[model samples]
Target: MNRVEIDGDRCKACGLCIDACNKHLLTLSSDLNAKGYHPIEIHDVEECSACALCGVICPEGSLAVYKEIKPKKGG
Candidate 1:
């Protein structure tokens, strides 16, 4: 499973990460963060493809995804 961490304090709620998530796993939270902006929330961690598009698209770089590496077959 991939681990996605969202720093609410730094998030500007630009919704870039939400749209960048290919898995449709990201959404803007209804609750406000310390900066008074809605933070991005990850739906299912198990469903995360670890594509890292959200992290890359984030203008604030508030999202970080950590993916487990699997050994390639027939290596």
Candidate 2:
């Protein structure tokens, strides 16, 4: 499964990642982080392609996307 990991403390609630995500997988949390800012989270995670657009758009560099890779049957 593909997913995004966010360092809430490092996030500034910019919402850039939310806009960058083509799959609409990002959303702002109602609660604030340690920095007193609302952080982004992966909400619609059913089909995350791990495009890294969110990470790229994140100015704070707090987002990391991970995608699971399947091994080949003949390998």
Candidate 3:
């Protein structure tokens, strides 16, 4: 499973992260940040693939993702 984390303080609300997500997993928040910019949000967590493109595109480094590491079975 993949999870999304957003750094509210660091986000610039540039919408770059929202544009980078091809899966349409991200959205712009209705509320504005302290800088008066709409923060990024994820509407559908299931659609996310943990690609990390949003985090890479974000200049403010406000986004991050963590994918589950499956365990290997031992004989």
lDDT tens readout by residue for model 2, 1-75: 887888999999989988899989888899899989988878768689999999998899998889889787997
lDDT of 1 by residue, 18-58 (tens): 78887899888899999899888888889998899998999
Worst 10 residues of 1 by lDDT: 14-23
- Candidate 3 structure quality by residue, lDDT tens digits, 1-73: 6899997767777888888999988888888788877888887787788889999999998888988776888
List the candidate 3 regions with Cα displacement exceeding 4 Å.
72-75
TM-score of each: 0.88, 0.90, 0.84
Candidate 3 backbone clash number: 0
**Candidate 2 — number of clashing residue pairs?**
0
What's the C-alpha lDDT at position 13 in model 3?
77
**What TM-score does candidate 1 reach?**
0.88
Choose 1 or 3, whichever is better by lDDT: 1
- As a TM-score, model 3 comes out at 0.84
Candidate 3 pairs with clashing backbones: none
* lDDT value, candidate 1, whole model: 0.88
lDDT, candidates in the order shown:
0.88, 0.88, 0.85
